[model samples]
Target chain A: MMSAKQADRLATAGLYAVAGVILALLAGLLGYVFVKGFPMLSWQFITSPPQIFKGGGGVGPQLFNSFYLLVLTLVFSLPVALGAGIYLAEYAKDNWLTRSIRISVEVLSSLPSIVVGLFGFLFFVIYMGWGFSIISGALALSVFNLPLLVRVVEQSIQSVPRTQREAGWALGFSKWETITNIVLPAALPGLITGIILAAGRVFGEAAALIYTAGMSTPALDFTDWNPLSPVSPLNPFRPAETMAVHIWKINGEGIMPDASAISDGAAALLILSILLFNLSARFVGRFVFKKMSAS
Target chain B: MQTVAVPSRVLSSQTHVTALTGPELTRPKLETDRLSVFYGDHQAVSDVCLTFKKNTVTALIGPSGCGKSTFLRALNRMNDSIEGCRMAGEIRYDGIELQSRQVNVLEVRKQIGMVFQRPVPFAKSIYKNVAYGPIRHGVKKKKELDRIVEDSLRKAALWDEVKDFLHQSALRLSGGQQQRLCIARALAMQPDVLLLDEPASALDPVSTAKIEELIGQLKKEITIIIVTHNMQQARRISDETAYFYMGRMVEHGPTEQIFSNPRSEQTRQYISGQIG
Candidate 1:
């Protein structure tokens, strides 16, 4: 019985209401976490290793391990993901094989992290004799991230306006030159988005690392410049417990006196750092696009 | 507005068609013989044989789906990138069989550069856009590159408008300016034949006039083959016109003769606006 104009307004209101609810939920969660955890996050808490005997020590090694792990995973996976993406988007013919590959990528991206963690445990950690080390952990995380990265890169490459590629060809630029100069540069913003998203996901991930990296950072020395030494943060062969794994392990043990405080501070740091990464990604992506495109 | 009035010449409207190649084939700058293009099972362009004299502009005119663009792309082997797209026949350039496996397509492309319908200035700076081709072909000295960039830009008539902002992105330029930048970029390659696929169809009247004028100037140096749906555009810019209909080359003759006195009833009907 209502007017069509009224119905249109109602639909518009419904969409905005849904959007508001989502924003509010996100804001409330972040506010609650900051209030509870900010006071516990001190420079000393982050720089000093865990006080196992007394319960008031810091998460210096775990924090360092998280950054180290993220870097290693990216170093291994980015190139592979980027190459596969370019091949899929630019080179592969539209056939059953190419179709199957796309389907495989989607399937891989949606698989549960825990299942991947189990695969890592059996293959990279046990079968490969990596013994729950940082190397094993990085490899596991690479498998988890590669599919998403590939999809992002492929879609971006595909999205590069067809006219640009045609222009390059018309100019007598070889296919390789065109791809390297035009397609890859044009896909920068999307690549940055993919990197930031993969990094954030890897930062929050604990299940996969737990199976591959194991529990406990055994007295890492930030001063140790030697990359190969056992205690150095750069030692990939050494056992490493990243921040997410530390939080999970500490809460489960329930033995430390200030366990709640430590967990809260860690969660606070995680959320804040993720927020920082997201913001910085926008700036970096824009900077790269502007410089590359010269606009 | 230096408009050159075309003095129309008339031919019989008997619809009798013949190949335009005279018995005294002086080994044209570029020639295609029985060139056909097929996309999988469907024929897109068929049996197009023509000779393009050096330093003359030839316009390919047709209705939509008449394969003018396809034929234009075939000239530069730009269609090679399309999957399931196949070409049969020979395209000769400077007496060399362009389709032969021995000919490096990269070299061929450098000699026969092309511009597209929409302006596709590289996402790079204006200076870089023109410089890219020369750099790809191994012109490394900064002095040489600078000279080439300036000359090409000047030749395309975009230098004065963009000379100050040479370092700025070409994308910032107006559409007309961007299209000119693309022309300069191709000119940097110093191609023998410049293929244009309706390069002004997406442009405004002013831009179209500018491009038409540029084509007139360019025809004094490089052989040009342009495809356009605008019948007036073909008549105004071209010395010769080839009409395409339903994937076949229907007629080829002097532009004025084709416009005023077409030998074919279809051509006459098409020109008089009775059919498209």
Candidate 2:
């Protein structure tokens, strides 16, 4: 049999090898994407609209649509997810109903985004008559977003030590008061990290948006800032195409002469934005945790 | 080893029971009758009846899992927060039954605060930690909160060390200082009773001595109930001592009587380190 020291060394080397393989894979993927797409990126390429039969097209509306859809998705999802999470973490008893709810959330979170897209298409797009619009895309995204958010919130709240709650109760604070003041503040870091990560997912989403938000953008008047105006970019009822959807569309059936170039630039921009989101999430989470915990 | 003789105010068995229950003229500050605490089906504390007089310290000494901590927690209804935990007993404060539905638990907790074995200071500034209790109770004025914070910290014997940087996070303080901050947090509510569960066990010797000193000073106004594993701790700080064994109070009397002249065989064995 191998000696304990030999076993330890072997285990350490094996772990390092596995870690190195993962790191190399990630680096390789990122490098390939950046190398192919970075050359196509330019100010004009980003700001101009897509061409039907021409060479020079920008992703300005699609980029705006990505962020707008993300904001709208959060607006639809965060409150309901937060409430459900708090209930599951703090108040729910170990009963059948709560157990089933937990199981359902788990199953729902594991479901494919495409399935959620179809459901949103059927329910929000056609049934609710919010056809091919940002609103429908947002509602569909919420279906995909809610379970993950609820789990994040529940785990974050549970991460707080039991002693903290006891301290609150010892001070004669009500249950709601304790949860709001002590628990939420302590869980803020995790909540912020979870939210921004979800935002990144929503920002990069294409499949759900294709079915619900439509594959084309309506002509938007740049000066028309009114949300109620049909021609306004801010109008939720208007068809909006996100950057990811644009990339997918151009690659699949584009008539533009520079479709491949535009796709490469959009893909690069999308990856960069997601990377930015992840980095910011880490920075903000750490900053808030430090500020709140003072350690 | 030089040992000094401590004068024993040891009372007879009859007189000791009478003393614990209190005389008609001096009503007990708090009393628990047939207090049995259970976590689900497991009984942790069984039929513990005790009386606490005002302006005095009573220490519950026992081995691990002897229900000393459970009994202490039950006084403030802290056990209510634990899942599957329940209590069957009457806890009276100032002649009012606290266990009754008529009594508001929040008000009881306000009047009776507890300090835990490990200090639990909120992840906030020292000043904010102390002011949190009073703010919830409607002491919202800036000046009043400031005054209350200072007064509570002073009472907890933490003001001298933390006064200069009260705005600093309580988490940054030493373990001893954080414990004191927790005490100060509870004291801000101006509670009549203070429950301490091994408040110094997690601290160093010097911090423990500071906590013991603080406890001695605090008993002048607050009815303090402490659960300690250290027999010496119970001897040094408490006016009354109750020895618990296997979820039962084996004996209780003046600290001197219980220590030097115990009535029960188990109490004597436990005291002598022969059995725990």
Off by over 4 Å in 1: B1-25
Which pairs of residues collide in model 1?
A51-A57, B11-B261
Worst 10 residues of 1 chain A by lDDT: A286-295
Tens-place lDDT digits, model 2, residues B140-201: 89999999999999998999998998877888999999999999999999999999999999
TM-score of each: 0.93, 0.93
Q: Give lDDT tens digits, candidate 2, residues A1-295.
A: 9999999999999999999999999999889889988998888777677778988888888878888898899999999999999999999999999999999999998888889889988998899999999999999999999998999999999999988998999899989999999999988988988898788888888888889999999887878999999999999998889999999999999988988888888999899878887897789777776676652
* TM-score of predicted structure 1: 0.93
* Cα displacement (Å) at residue B162, model 1: 1.2
lDDT of 2 at B258: 93
